[model samples]
Target: MHRLLVVLCISVALVAGAEQDVLELTDDNFNSVLKQHETTLVMFYAPWCGHCKRLKPEYAKAAELVKGDDPPIALAKVDCTEAGKETCGKFSVSGYPTLKIFRGDSVSQDYSGPREANGIVKYMRAQVGPASRNIKSIDEINKFLDTKDTTIFGFFEDPDVALAKLFVKFADKNREKYRFGHSNDPDVLAKYGETEKIVLFRAPHLANKFEETNVQFEGSSESELSTFVKENFHGLVGHRTQDTIRDFKNPLIVAYYSVDYVKNPKGTNYWRNRVLKVAKEFTNKATFAISAKDDFQHELNEYGYDFVGDKPVILARDEKNLKYALKEEFSVENLRDFVEKLLDGELEPYVKSEPIPENNNAPVKVAVAKNFDEVVINNNKDTLVEFYAPWCGHCKKLAPVFDEVAEKLENEEVDLVKMDATANDVPPEFNVRGFPTLFWLPKNQKDKPVAYNEGREVDDFIKYIAKHATNELNGFDRSGKSKKTEL
Candidate 1:
């Protein structure tokens, strides 16, 4: 009797743990199963793919939640490595874990959405019918807002307007995360205080109990309008678009790269695996973003960078009107250092373009990007270098003052130099993200270069140089007075 009870308990536990909500389909039964269910979400997956393995549990959980729906949405999976090769090939399943929805044995749509259980369930629910609803009356507006956490409503004079069509397209893509409605009624338009053709309505929820607020769409382009909606709706680390740039209030760090999932799966993981790690660490301090190189070509041109040449360029922008580009190769360590400097207010602002300064035959020597190491690193003398841009008004003011200070220290063993940072690259240690950045390199090769942030006056420069010079100055004391000091 005891042995039989134990056996019965083990059998019940095994049956309970078994996944019954999801159907396991093969090439033989794939067509037959689709015929039975009105709506079916099919996942074509390979056994060896790591991403597919990670997605399995989440997909199972979503299937269990969606099993009890009114229409009973069916969840099914096909192992392409085994018996579903023909079926997978039919749907062009190049990547592992490809999800596609079949409706009424004819209509089908690809699912490119969040992979979490809740996200999958919500997305499949939206696929049951048209993602966005058409609002016919003012009473419908009130009822819709009451149910949804956030809803974007488009109100136009006619249903055939270009904006309405654009709104529908966007709605279909993001229906899982947001509720969308459209109306051509004049009373509904007057009730929502909408003068434009489209507006986003933020409904009152537990987090925000305030009344609904309307966000008007002011841009003419579809990409611009779509970007605005995404930025307002999504969390941190969203896709960077032209419209989103204007709404960036906090410091932003952007990674521009091309991700090819088919050719290199590891490269596609670079954004989530590598970049997101840095973003998570500094979630409060900055907003991290990834933008496709092709989509943001014009924006990249404004920063004086060729997005095509350098794949995966990292850049930083702050509210203080400073823009900085990473000088070193892309790595976790390099990115962390770049962000740390930005937070510490150590980086210099980047400029678009600047002409090379003419050799004015002054005491200050000129350094270029190619010869930076030859001039500053190889030299034994203590060096004071000014990294400047030609277009900077502040740099223009400091040029004469720098020349006078260089003239005063010509007789000393110290070397004074200036370089056009826009035209030339400097070492990563220079941290030149702004105009007229100054650094003091000590004579001893062991010592690192120190930024000179004191006033740029002739006296200030002389005092700093004298203090850091290797040999004792004959005319200046420790306090920069005219008292002679011994070596």
Candidate 2:
């Protein structure tokens, strides 16, 4: 009976492995195949990967199933054991069954875990980035700690009942953001226990300031250990910075914290330290404070604020705008990291509510419109003036775009103004027949606006401005070809 069962299992495995054709990818046709297909599933696997070996037939079955539903997703495998070392490194593949999904040219999602064919099929169907694996090495763990994103790192002696309970307690609430891991090696545990010795073992050349986090924990209960770990290490997670936090002179106030907030004095103290560390980095860049004593609302009201959430709030503003950046556990590293991201033009601010200014249409005191005054235009300086009504859908869409354009052109001497055609204050003679016609007055007189084209062409509009706007301030980077900022 045992022999018969073994034969059946092997036969089933063989049939499953043969279910789909696996394309072998080399450097040659990788880009072409990826570009040509709507959806491509590329697996980076190694011969030594026990997980990969098990996942092979499962992947083949998944490919067959997915193909049935969606013209089939192309399945290809790269053997790290063979000649695909560079390919694995390019994708940042640290583990096997590293499934990357590409939709045309861009990678949409990635997966790494114990996945059967059905599991892979289900994951592919959802088309989301796979759940990230836990950080293994102490270096990787430190990186997670320093990340701006909320992170949880679990240190378990064994994958036993107690550890399982801890995971069950927090995993649902924290999910992929948290790290759950363990080490049975006594040498590994002893090093990470009480000093910089573990850090030296993990990262030999780490700087002193960076290496200071290596320490000991004197606790037995899960709560005690949790408190100790978070208090000492939680603040390393990423945070919002002064640059992206606000442009307003009115202090960029932020509340730093761990995403996990335990109702204890120690936990609170830990949270406070993290917030201060973040605040200190942007000392003069903006004002700083913590949400201790639940005084967030009081402080916000006193200073005029706009922010999101209670855990880690960052309210920033200059003279004119007060905006909120993100809602997560905060830290100093994150605040500075977020600032660096903003410098890279990667930080994105979302609009939750629009501010109702006292004078929604304040007088255009900056410039007065005169009749036939050569319809003042400039491209070297991108000037954008829009005629619109608040009720119109098209106007609403264009309004956000206009706001983005203005933000992007903040220091570029770009004249961004809006005229309400519906308002009685403006002259009736400024007869704009259409509801929202944009006037792009570029610096170059040759590219003058002869007529109005009512359509949303963000790229064209930016180009028109760049060409004509006289950038006397040297705001735009002129080193490379003119790259229009996508507002």
Best-matching candidate per TM-score: 1
Q: Give the TM-score of candidate 1.
A: 0.42
Per-candidate local distance difference test: 0.73, 0.51
Stretches of candidate 1 off by over 4 Å are 1-19, 46-49, 64-73, 80-95, 104-111, 118-128, 137-143, 146-149, 160-179, 184-197, 203-213, 219-224, 234-487
Model 1, position 28: C-alpha lDDT score: 96
Per-residue lDDT tens digits for candidate 2, residues 378-400, read: 22444566777768788888776
Error of 2 at 117 (Å): 28
Task: Give the poorly placed runs of model 2, Cα more than 4 Å off.
Answer: 1-151, 168-180, 194-315, 318-393, 396-487
- How well does each candidate superpose onto the true structure, as a TM-score? 0.42, 0.26
